[model samples]
Target: MSEPAEDPQELAALRNEIDEVEREVVRTVDLGPRAVVIAAAVFVLIVGLVLPWMGGANGLEVLLGQHEAVGKASWVPRLFATTSIGFGVLGSALAIITRRWALTWVCALGGWFASVDGVLAIWSRQSSAGPGASAPGIGLIIAEIATVVIASLWFRTAWSRS
Candidate 1:
C-alpha cells in the first residue's frame, strides 16, 4: 500500500508539540525518584480542585462563584480545599529540588496542617442528620489524601536526612 504524502506544515506542528511535551516532562523530573511521587500527588491535588468538593458544584465552581466566604470558620475547609494544592506543588517541588532543610520543614509542617484541614473539611460537610447532607465529594477526599501523603513523605525525608 502506498503511504499518503505528509504535509510539511502539519509535520512541523506535530514536531513542535512533541518538543513542548518533552520539555514539560523534563522539568518534572528534577527530583529523581521523589519527583515521580511528588508529581503524581500534585497532579491529584490539582485535579481535585476541579472536582466536586461538596454541595452541587465542584471546587472551582464554589471558589469562582457564590462562595460562602464569610465567618472565620468558613475559611477552614476553603483554605485547605484550595491552598493545599498550591503548597503541595510549590513546597514539594522546591524542597525536593533544592534539598534545603529549611524548605523541607516548611513543606512538612505546612503539609501536615493542610492535611488536618482537609480531614476537617470532610467532617464539616458530613450530614449528622443522614441523607440530608450533600456529603463530601471525591475531589476534597482525594486532595486530603494527597496532602497526607505529601506530608508523610516530606516528613520521612526530613527525618532520614536529620
Candidate 2:
C-alpha cells in the first residue's frame, strides 16, 4: 500500500507558496539607477533639514523647538518639513522596497503635492512678511527641489518596471 499522505492538496499548495515566498525574500534584484536617484532624493531632503530655512531658524529648529520662531516665522516651514520627509521621502522609499505598484503611485503623487506645497508655502511666507524680512532660507529651497526630484524618480521607476 502507498504511504499515507502527509498533507492534503490545499495544504501542500500553501506550503509550496510559503517556500516560494522564502526564496523571494532571500533572492536580490538590481535596483539600479532608479534606486540611486531615490537615495539621492532622500539624502538631499534630509540634509536640507539641517540647513537654515529662514533668517535664523533652520528646518530642524522649526520642527524640534519654537525658540527660533521668536520673530514672525510662519507655520509653512514646519508643515513642509514634516510632509516632505515623512511622506515624500520615507513613504516612497518603503513602497519601492516592497515593490508595491499602487503604493508607488500614491507616494509619487503625494510627494509631488507635498513638494509643491513646500515651494508655495515659502513664497507665501515671503510675500506675507513685512518689508525688509529675510527671504526663505536655503534649507526650504533645497528641500523643495529634492522633493520634486523624488516624485519624478518614483514615477519613472514605477513606469519603467515591466
Candidate 3:
C-alpha cells in the first residue's frame, strides 16, 4: 500500500485533540478518590446523628453515668438526652466539613469513651445498685457497647480511606 502525505495542520489538530482527552481523563481520575471520601464522610456523619435520636438517648446516658453522676431523676435524664442529641448533630456537621485525621481521631476516641462508660452504667444498674442508678439494665448496656463500637469502627475506616 502507498503511504499518503501528512499535512502539518492536520498533525497539530490531532495532537491538540489528544491533549484535551488526556486532560479530561486525568481530571476524572483525580476526582474518583475524593468522591469516595466525601461519600463515606457523609454517611458516617448521618449515622452519628441518627443513632442518638432513634433510641440512643438511653444508651448515651448509660455511657455518661459511668464517668459522672447522673441523677436520672426528672430533668437529669432530659439534660443528658439533649446533650447527646446536640453533640451527635454537631459531630455530624464537623465530619462533613473537615478532612483532617485529627477530627476522625476525635470521633474514634469519643466512641470508645461512650462505650466504656456504657459498660459502667450497666454495672450500676444492677438490682443491688443504688437508687441513683436510675434506668437501664444489662440489656441496654450490651446494646450501647455494640453501637459505640460500630460507630467508632465506621469512623476509623472512613478516616483511613483518605
Candidate 4:
C-alpha cells in the first residue's frame, strides 16, 4: 500500500517560519561603518603583537614567557597581553563575523577591560624600569591605543543600535 502524503499547508507554514528566523538572524548583525572601523583597530592590535613589547622581545614572546624580560616582567603586562589577544583579537573577530548585537556588547565591555589592563601594563613597565627591567616598548603602546579605539567604536555601535 502507498504511504499517506504530508499536509501541504503544514509544510508551507514550517518553511515560512524557517525563513522568518533566517531573516531575523541576518537583521541582528551589524554590517555598517562602525563594524569596519572596529575591525581595522583589531588589525592594528594584531600587528602590535609582532612588534617589540618588552626588552627586545615581541608581544608574542612576552605572552609566552619565553623572553629574557619575562623573568622580570610583572603580572600586569602579561595580563594585558592575554586580554588583548582574548578580547581585542578573538572577541572582536567573533563579533564581526557573527554580526550579533549581543556579541557586540560583550566585545565592547571586554575591550574596555582590556584597555584598563593595557594602562596598568604600561604603568608597571615604567615603574619597574631598572638596570635589567625594560620600559614599555612601541608595540605595547600601539596595542593600548588600538584597544581603546576598538572599545570606543564598539561602545558607539552598541549605543546606537535600537
Model 1 lDDT per residue over 15-122, tens place = 999999976654332345775787788788778878777665566654454444322334556777556855687888787776666677788899998988888878
Clashes of each: 0, 0, 0, 0
Tell me which residue pairs clash in candidate 4.
Answer: none
In model 4, which regions exceed 4 Å deviation?
Answer: 1-27
Candidate ordering by TM-score (highest first): 4, 2, 1, 3
Per-residue C-alpha lDDT of model 3 across residues 1-162, encoded as one tens digit per residue: 998989989999999999999766543212235435534543443443334321234335433543243444323233323333333334434644554345555555655555554445444444325543444533343444443644455365445543
Tell me the whole-model lDDT of each prediction, alpha carbons only. 0.72, 0.75, 0.45, 0.86
Ranking by lDDT: 4, 2, 1, 3
Error of 2 at 144 (Å): 0.6
Q: Which segments of model 1 are wrong by more than 4 Å?
A: 1-31, 63-73, 127-133
- Per-candidate TM-scores read 0.67, 0.73, 0.40, 0.83
What is the Cα-based lDDT of residue 94 in candidate 4? 88
**For residue 116, what is the lDDT in candidate 3?**
55
lDDT of candidate model 2 versus the reference: 0.75
Encode model 4's per-residue lDDT on 5-106: one tens digit a residue. 879999899999999998787557656787778888989999988889888888888888888777755678888899999988998898888888888788
- Model 1: lowest-lDDT 10 consecutive positions: 65-74
| Model 3, residue pairs in steric clash | none
User: Which candidate number has the best lDDT?
Assistant: 4
Q: How close is candidate 4 to the true structure, as a TM-score?
A: 0.83
